[model samples]
Structure formats: C-alpha cells, structure tokens
Target: MIRYIKNIFLGIYCLLQGMYISMLNMIRPKVTEKYPENRGRKEMMERFRGLLTMPHNEQNEHKCTACGICMINCPNGTIQVISRKEPDEATGKEKRVLDRHLYDLGSCTFCALCTIACPQDAIAWSPVFEHTVFTRNKLVKQLNREGSKLEVKTGKS
Candidate 1:
C-alpha cells in the first residue's frame, strides 16, 4: 500500500514538471518571421546566399575570358560558355571572345561550385532573393548583357 502511494506521488511530480516546462516556454517571446515581405534591408542576414549572378561593370564589360573553367566544375552542367575567335582590329591577331554565358538556374543547386571554380571571378551570389517564376524557360538566363565584351584586366593599378 505504501509503495503504491509513492508511485502515485512520483507520477504526479513528473506531470507537474512537464507542465512547468511548458509554461516557461509559453511565456517566452516568439521568434517567427513574416516572410515574402521586404520590410527592410536590415532583415537580411549577412551570410544569406541567394541567386548566382555575373556582375557586369558600369561599362557593360565582364572579366570572363570564356575559359570554360566554371562549366567544367559545375556538378549539374548548369553553366555553359560559348566563345568565338575574332580578329583584333588593333593587333590584327585572333582573340577568343565570349559569345554567350548560359546559366540554367532551374538545374542549379546553388552550391557555388561554378563561382568557386572560376579563374576570372566571373560569377558571384547576388543578394536579391525574389526568384519566383512561372516558366522554366525564364530560369535559363544569359549572364552576360547583350553587346558586352570581356575586358582585359591589366596588372597595373
């Protein structure tokens, strides 16, 4: 009879302990965020990786020399580099120039493998994260702007 009474008190103690923990958690502040609303730039974290982007400078020029290093390192074949040789007007010599840089965001896992493997630093992650699209064709994008050419980076500052 005494052992049975002890077990009942033990069970009640356990139940009260669980209820105390629940009450503590219920009184704490909520941490849920309201997404899809760009309230402010302060809401974005510093290390948040979004879309892979190729930055073209103000002159509409890029650093990619069509080396195909990014395409080779991509795990899902997301990057495609197209190039053509054109005679340089200044030197009368043939130079390989980038015709297109096809980036398929649909197949891309955003592992940043292509950007990390690029020798010319041609690719990077952009902070803009609103990538909702209706069609798959819209996901496949040409990184380089139309008429934009590769700029030769001189060692001289």
Candidate 2:
C-alpha cells in the first residue's frame, strides 16, 4: 500500500515534468517556418543547382551555336541541340544557327558537365528552383527563349 502511493506520486511527477517541458517549448520562439505561407520569394542558395538555362544579354542575345558539344558530353542524353542553316546578318548564304536547345531537367543529373563542355559558354545554372510543375512536359524546357535570335559575332574590334 505504501509502495502503491509512492508509484502514483512518481507517475504524476513525471507527467508534470513532461507537460512543463512541452509548455516551455510551446512559448519559445518559433524554430520552423510556416512553409508555403512564409517562404522567401527568392529562397535559392548561392551555389544551389537548378535547371540549366541559357542567359541572354541585355540586348537579348545568346552564344549557343548549336555545336552539339554539350549534347555529346551529357552522359544521360538530357540535352538535344537542334540546328539549321539560316542566313547570317551580313551574308545571304546559309550558316549554322541554333534552332532550339532542349533541356530535360528531369533526366539531368546537374553534374555541370554540359556547362563545362560548352566552348561558347552558352549554358549555365539558374537559381530559380520554382520550376516544379504537375506534368513531366513542363519540366523539359527549351533553354532558348522564343522569338529570340543568337548573338552573331560579326567582326573583331
């Protein structure tokens, strides 16, 4: 009977201890974000790896020549460079131009191999991680912007 009373007190003491700790934690400053509601607009890290992209200059020009170097270097076949013979700025004759540069981010390993293989420095990593979508087709993006032309190197200054 004495042991029973002591056990009851011990159990109550432990319950109170747990509740006290929980209460203290509950009143403390929040340790986690509220997620979607409180997430930062630009939350990507400096070195964060994301979908590969082709950067256009202020004048909206890219350096991709459709050399297929990146495509050849990609181990997973994630890159496909489409090329066509198009008229240059000065010449009427046909010249190789990049028609489309497709990037399958879903299959990409983000190994940076394609960027390293690009001699023209056409492709690079973008910090935009909000590219998530419902369908797989949305993940496969064409790096070249629509209606945008490549930057043709004409002459030496």
Candidate 3:
C-alpha cells in the first residue's frame, strides 16, 4: 500500500515537471521560419553549398586551365572538361585550350571534391539553391561562357 502511494506521488511529480517544461517552451519566442511568406527575407547559412559555378572576371576571363583535375577528383562522373588544341600566339606551338566545362547537377552529390581539387580555384559553390527543373537535361550546365578566355597570369610577382 505504501509503495503504491509513493509510485503515484512520483508519477505526479513527473507530470508536473513535464508540464513545467511545456509551459516554459510555450512562453518562449517562436523560432520556426515563416518559409514561403518570408521567402524574400529568408537567408541561407554561410556554409550552405548549393551549386557549382565557374567565376569570370570583368574581362570575361576564367582561371580554369582545363587540367581535368576537377573532373578526375569528382566521386561521380559529374564534371566533364573538354579541351581543343590551339596554336599559342606567343610560342607558335600547339596548346590545349578549354573547349567546354560541363557540370551535371543531377548526378552531383555536392561532395565539393572537385572544387577542393582544382589547382586554379576555377570552381566554387553558388549560394542560389533554387534548382527546380522539369527535365534532368536542364541540370547539365556549361560553366564556361561563350567568348570567355582563360586568364593567364603575366610575370611572377
């Protein structure tokens, strides 16, 4: 009889403790984002990796050397670096130039290996995460812009 009474008291104490916690939470400010309503004001965290991009300068020049390192480093076959032989004006010798840099967003795991492995810092993650698409073909992107040329560093500092 005594043990039963003690169990009842313990259960009431536990119930009161739970209620206290619930009351405390109810009085606190809401942390849940309003989502669609607050879409304009919504901001992604700084470290969020959304998509891969190749940055170009004001002169429409990029630092990618078409080394194929990014493609090789990718765990999946998400990156493709196509190159073509062109005659260098200064040396008058055949040089490999980047014809295209293709990135398949559909297959990419966003492991960031390609960006990390790039020796030229050619690739980076874009903050824009809106990737809604009707077809998978749309996910494949050409990183290099038309008429964009490789930015070669001049004299060593």
Candidate 4:
C-alpha cells in the first residue's frame, strides 16, 4: 500500500513537469510562415536556380557552335543537340553547324555539367527559380533560337 502511494506521487510529479514544459512552448514565438496568403509576394533567394534563359548578342544571334560536348556530358540526357555540316568558304573544311539545341529543364539536376563542358562557352544558369508550370512539356527550352544566344560568358559574378 505504501509503495503504491509513492508511485502515484511520482507519476503526478512527472505529469506536472511535462505540462509546465508544454505551456512554456505555447508562449514561445514561432517563425513559421503562413503560406498561400503570402504567395507571389514573398521574396526569393539570390542564389536560387530557377528557369533557363537563352542569351542574345547585340545582333540577337546565338553563339552555339553545335558542339556535342554538352549533350554527351549531361548525366540525365536533359540536353539534345542537332548538328549540320557546312563547308567553310575560307578554310574549305567541313564545319559542324549548330542546327538546334533543346534543353528539357524538367529532368535537369542543375549540376552545371553542360555549362562546364561546352567548348564554345555556351549555356548559363539563370536566377529565376519560381517557374511553376501546368505541364512538363512547358519546361523544355530550345537554346538555338534565331535571335537569342546562350549567354555562356555572362552570369552573376
């Protein structure tokens, strides 16, 4: 009977301690942000990697040389390159042409492998990460646009 009474007293003491801790937590300030209510208005990080944009020169021409290095180096095969052979008038040597460069951003890991592998210094990572699309097809971007070039040399320093 005495041991039973002692155990009940100890249990009560533990329960009171737990209640005290929970009450303290309830009064503490929370840093959790309420979502949807603050959507689109919130600021994004500076280093956040988002959407890919093709860069253009003053003439609005692309600089891609149709090199297959980027396509070969991509781990997920997210980049596709189409090349055409044309004869150089001065050198008379058959030069590879950059017909098309397609990039599927949906499967890209943003590891910057393609950017580093390009010999012509094509491809860049843009700071626009908030691209939420309804379908996966919308995420693919064609790099070899008529007036737009890949800004391989210029990016956030």
Per TM-score, the best of the predicted structures is 3
Candidate 2 worst ten-residue window by lDDT: 33-42
Query: Candidate 3 local accuracy as lDDT?
Result: 0.93
What tens digits encode model 3's per-residue C-alpha lDDT throughout 66-108? 9999989989899999999999999999998999999999999
Candidate 2 accuracy as TM-score: 0.70
8-87, model 2: which lDDT tens digit per residue?
Answer: 99999999999999999999998665668865654766777877999998777998989899999999999999989987
TM-score, per-candidate, Cα-based = 0.77, 0.70, 0.84, 0.62
- Order the candidate numbers by TM-score, best to worst: 3, 1, 2, 4
Find the candidate with the highest lDDT and give its number: 3
How many steric clashes does model 1 contain?
A: 0
Kindly list the per-residue Cα lDDT of model 4 for residues 43-155, writing each as its tens digit: 66665566555566776666687778888999998998988788876699998777778899889988887877777666676776566889999888887676443344467
lDDT measured at residue 74 in model 4 versus the true structure, 0 to 100: 92
lDDT of each: 0.86, 0.87, 0.93, 0.77
Candidate 2 clashing pairs, residues 3+ apart or interchain: none
RMSD in order of candidates: 3.0, 6.1, 2.3, 5.4
Off by over 4 Å in 2: 1-38, 154-157
lDDT score of residue 131 within candidate 4: 66
